[model samples]
Target: MKLGFIGTGKITAAVVQGLCTSGIDGLSIAVSPRNEATSSFLAQHFSNVRRMHSNQQVLDHADIVCIAVRPDQAAHVLSQLRFREDHIVVSFVSFLTCHELVRAVAPARQSCRAIPLPSVIHHTCPIPVFPAIGPVMDLFSTIGQPVTVDNETQLHALWTLTGLISPFYDLLGSLSDWTVSHGVRPDTASQFTADLFQSLAHAARQSDPIAFDALAHHAATPNGMNEQAAHEILASGAHQAYRQACDRLVQRFPILDE
Candidate 1:
């Protein structure tokens, strides 16, 4: 299968890198010239990857077309390209609804919206795709766990959770700084912080049936440091603040009704 990407940004780079190393056979990946560094890097490093001079060149040769442009640039970029009925259009534009994508890529009967994070580069992360397309699902699953949702509203809700990634990093950074202030070496503190969460995340993934609250409670003993910290954080409304932030982000991406 031939794959084409319209915007060669971070997410595009990650997905391309994932696919190139995913062991998927007979795949030729073409990327836009928008991000020269990323495009050149992929083309130079991957034998199956090519850097296209223009967006149209990608569409002209690819069976599957991926739209990864910025939200603001989506209209102008997509308006210039023409899609065929056989093209499978997958959009990574967070704010672009399925309705808008169908209109933008008219005559392309197949289209879906997807959210892939940087973890995709490491073949780790949840890829939430709306209105599941078989080939697309197969492709994403090779790199990450793909969750298919038929409802656009629910898909938008999942996308809202992806927004928490930055806040998650901030929490890790703050904890690392706390450790560093206590005389720990910078590299040691950073490694500990990352490894600690990685182990926790791995446990969560392995124990699929376990409730998150149960795990949280399991980590805290009565009158323990974990319990005290959890109590203080709850008292400060930190969890509620995170929920409010998610609500605000959900409002930013509205899905149109059919």
Candidate 2:
């Protein structure tokens, strides 16, 4: 199958690298020259990937097109390209609705919204794809865990959760810093914190039937350090503050899917 990407940014590079190394056969990729460095890097690194001279050229050569352009640039960029009636479009551009994309990529009857995290480079992230058409589903499934939601509202809510990634890394950094201050080497502390969180995440993923609250309870024995820290954090209202932030973000979403 031929896959083309209209923008060559980090997300695009990650998806391309994942797909190229995915062992999914008969896949060739066309990338736009919008970002020359990234496009050139992919074409040079992956034998099956090709760098196109233009965005229209990407659409012209591939059956399925993925748009990874910024939200602010989407309307302007899409206005210049033409899509075919048979083309299937998957947009990685946030804040752009399926309705808007359908109009922009008119005649390309099918389209979907997707949010892929940087972890997709490792082919292990949860890629939430709205509408979940078969061809797009297959693409996401190859690179990451494909999450199909009922509507765009649900998809947007999931995307909002992605905003927490930085906060998560910050938490890890804080832990690593504390360890370093307490005499551990910087690299040792960083590695320990990263591996610790990774193991916790792995355990959470493995515990499919377990609710997060239940998992937390299981890890926290009475008067134990985990319980003590959990109590203090709850008392500090940090979790409530995070929820409030998420509510504010959802309110700011431009797409009126509600």
Candidate 3:
């Protein structure tokens, strides 16, 4: 199958690298020339990839087209391209909705919203949120686990979760920096924090299904250091600040209706 990416940015490059390494047969990709460095890099590094002169060229050559532009640029960029009813258009732009895209590319057979992080490049599995489409489900299944959403609201919730990633990384970085200040080497502190978090995440995933609060309680004993620290942070408004940040995301990207 032929796949074309409309925007050759970081996320697009990651997806292209992931697909290239996946060794999926007969898969060829054409990316737009907007991000020349990344597009050229992919073309040079991947035998099956090519850098296209324009976004329209990508749509012209591929069976599956991924609209990888930012939400702000989506309307303007999509206004210039044309698509057929049979083409599959998967958009990674967060604020754009299926209905809006359908209107942008009238008569397209299938259109879905997908939110993929750079992790897809390592075949670590992308969290895909589709509005119940079989072809999209089949395509993303090859890269990672596919999640289907019943409505656009749920999809927006998924997007909100995506927004949390950067803040989460910042929190981790702050903790790692504190360790470095306490005398550990910078690299060692970051690595230790990452490894410890990875193990904790793995354990949480494998453990019996239970409320996260229960696990937190088990991990933090009564009047212990962990509990004391947790209480102090909560008292310092850290937890509330995180909640407010999430609320702000929801407000910024209001839920799209079905």
TM-score of 2: 0.97
Residue 54 in candidate 3, Cα distance off native in Å:
2.2
lDDT, candidate 2, equals 0.92
Which residue pairs overlap in candidate 3's backbone? none
Question: What lDDT does the true structure give each of the candidates?
Answer: 0.93, 0.92, 0.84
In order of appearance, the predictions have TM-scores of 0.97, 0.97, 0.94
Residue-by-residue lDDT tens digits, candidate 1, 33-151: 98999899999999999999999999988999999999999999999998999999999999999989999999999999999899998998799998899999999998999997878
The reply for model 1, stretches above 4 Å from the true place, is none
Per-residue alpha-carbon lDDT of candidate 2 for residues 1-258, written as tens digits (9 for 90 to 100) = 999999999999999999998999999999999699999999999999999998999999999999999989999999999899999999998889888989999989889989988888899999999889899998889889999899888988999898888888998999899999999999999999999999988898888785899989999999999999999999999999889989988876675645
Full candidate order by lDDT, most accurate first: 1, 2, 3
Candidate 3: tens digits of C-alpha lDDT, residues 167-214: 889988999999998999999999999999888888787778946787
Indicate the residue-level lDDT of 178 in model 3: 99
For candidate 3, which ten residues in a row score worst on lDDT?
249-258
TM-score order, best first, reads 2, 1, 3
